[model samples]
Target: MEMTGKCRLLGIVAALATATPVVAADAADVYGAPPIESGWKYQVALDGWFTALDGSIGLRGLPAADVNVSALDAIEHLEGAFAASFQATGDSWLLYSDFMWSKISADADVGPFGGTVGFEQEQVLFTALVGYEVPVNIQNMQLYATGGLRYQHYSVDLSIDPVFFPGINRSGSQSWVDPIVGMALHYDINDRWFVDVMADVGGFGIASDITLQGTATVGYNWTDTISSSFGYRALYTDHSDGGFRYDATQHGLFTRLSFHF
Candidate 1:
């Protein structure tokens, strides 16, 4: 009997050891939800605001004379944007590819010229990001910073009214590859509700000068599937020609609605 009892105890120990891995795997799957391998997200936004532009225009080699003019002015503004992102996640790392298009239109009156200028800027960015969640007692709060490369295209048109300049139209398109950097703070009210604030800044090519853009937003997530946000954005650009300089500033309020899958 003693021999049989000892064998039974040994058999129980072996069974528990064999079942340990299976139990642990099941617990991990239940507690540590993994990110989807692939998914698509889309967003649309509406924006409105005021803008100010300050720059100097130089006219050289015109009728054997050089003319330099400085302008400081502001305008009423309106804008919109659309964005889509594809996501990839790992145990301790996450990657996202984002494509976004933003447009702004405003009118400014300077000197004897009363005209409207509009700009549309678009970007496709790919980033490999690594993030760590803070070890706070609160659940679902994360802070992350990302740096990557972005390809940007900017289109601008300045139209002078017939009252200002008989028939003068100025328009140009520029594209460049630039470095992008950003930071984000996200808080989850629950599994299906959250808020985020994000900011990004970058510079384009040599001729394009330097540019900075920032935005702040409050948002809500639905069913871990859809999101809607309202926010404000500001942009500044310092552009220079061979002998001329153009400084532009724009600010606006925006609303965004997005779907994630």
Candidate 2:
């Protein structure tokens, strides 16, 4: 794929940028972290989410149809997929990015047509963010506020297939980029464990009517450059135009293994 090269380049840059103090196992006691060293820091994280999605989609001459299912169910019918994340940091600044893509085929019963329906769904999402760590008086805690851009693209191909009538195929796509702002809070309970909470809001008429995302995680510092985390994440968006509408919520347990450098 043409995007393969771009993905690789992004990964490399993230690896270079993500090496910072958040993942360090040993640091001074200000917050169980040392002041950011004067070079590039990077991290690569692999995450898995047992995702469930709920939404509605529509085509020309047809009313919007609801879509709700587990990502595992969609993957059972998937054609291809890819997902990953990268981060780079400085003493007080950070850069992060992530990408996800999936293609699935599913069955939908169309109420208006009074027949069984089939559809293919393809989705791609990418987010790039830059954050600055804020000085906090609270002990053993770090706060960061960030701003970024999120790109989302979704497409659906519908087939009204049955023995009774001629088959009809309809396809439509929607893509948008929205500016987002959010905050992250991290607190170290001890040397080996920490907690993180984050939330973001976006899509102020830029694409969707509104969009929101939130996450909470507990992390275990395993080594000087490795950490593990488990979290719950949720994302919601409402988007509509004349012919295409995509309103959905995706939430699930998310786990990650991260490497720092």
Candidate 3:
């Protein structure tokens, strides 16, 4: 476990950089809500997630280690990041897609070894879903049942250089896909305001043992084709393969600006 300390330090970087929020079809519901609109409507959004990471992670068969990093702490190590979402709704059906990517790296002292260890990681997350809107009895409210696939890819590189021992370098990558099912609810409070809530669960051991996500947002319509939302989101994932493991929960405040057509 000579590299455990370095792993823990860099794990914080990985967790924070990977904290992109999950996106849903109802992200812009205030602007394009249902009574089952007949024509096709489309929306594109840019999202920001300020999240904290808490949980354990293991790399290359190393024992699981703890990581708890605040959003502010993660910002220092994040190299690059991006997140975006798109949705199209027709008479009772909707198609939604989201993509997120991040890269992070860190350097730490290797105990008393008089050397430095560096770690870097890059991750990508993507989701696609098709859903059918079901009119509910509640006035000004709509519900949608959705099913989808989530894809994840990760690449990591670790290097250790010590004064007394030979240098060590390791690099590896993994990818997996999971099937998810969920529901979304949108309620219009008035002509200009609305609320949305969504939840989903998946994995079933097909890839990760389990994965869960939830979000709640309050939205405002700026115009017929523009809207904004602010909310809270939480996501959890657990996966292990070939000695690499990632089990963590990411949660925080999120905001989005969306355009509709």
Best by TM-score: 2
Each prediction's whole-model lDDT (CA): 0.51, 0.83, 0.82
What TM-score, to 2 decimals, does candidate 1 have?
0.57
Instruction: Give the C-alpha miss distance for residue 159 in model 2, angstroms.
Output: 2.9
lDDT for each residue of candidate 3 in 138-206, tens digit (9 for 90 to 100): 998878999999998878676778888887776778899999999878799999999978788999999
Candidate 1: list runs displaced more than 4 Å: 1-14, 21-82, 86-90, 102-139, 159-168, 191-193, 204-209, 239-246
Spell out the clash pairs found in candidate 2.
17-41, 17-88, 17-89, 18-41, 18-42, 18-43, 18-87, 18-88, 19-41, 19-42
TM-score for each model:
0.57, 0.77, 0.76
Minimal lDDT window, size 10, model 2: 21-30
- Which stretches of model 3 miss by more than 4 angstroms? 1-37, 106-119, 158-170
**Where does model 2 exceed 4 Å of error?**
1-40, 108-114, 161-168
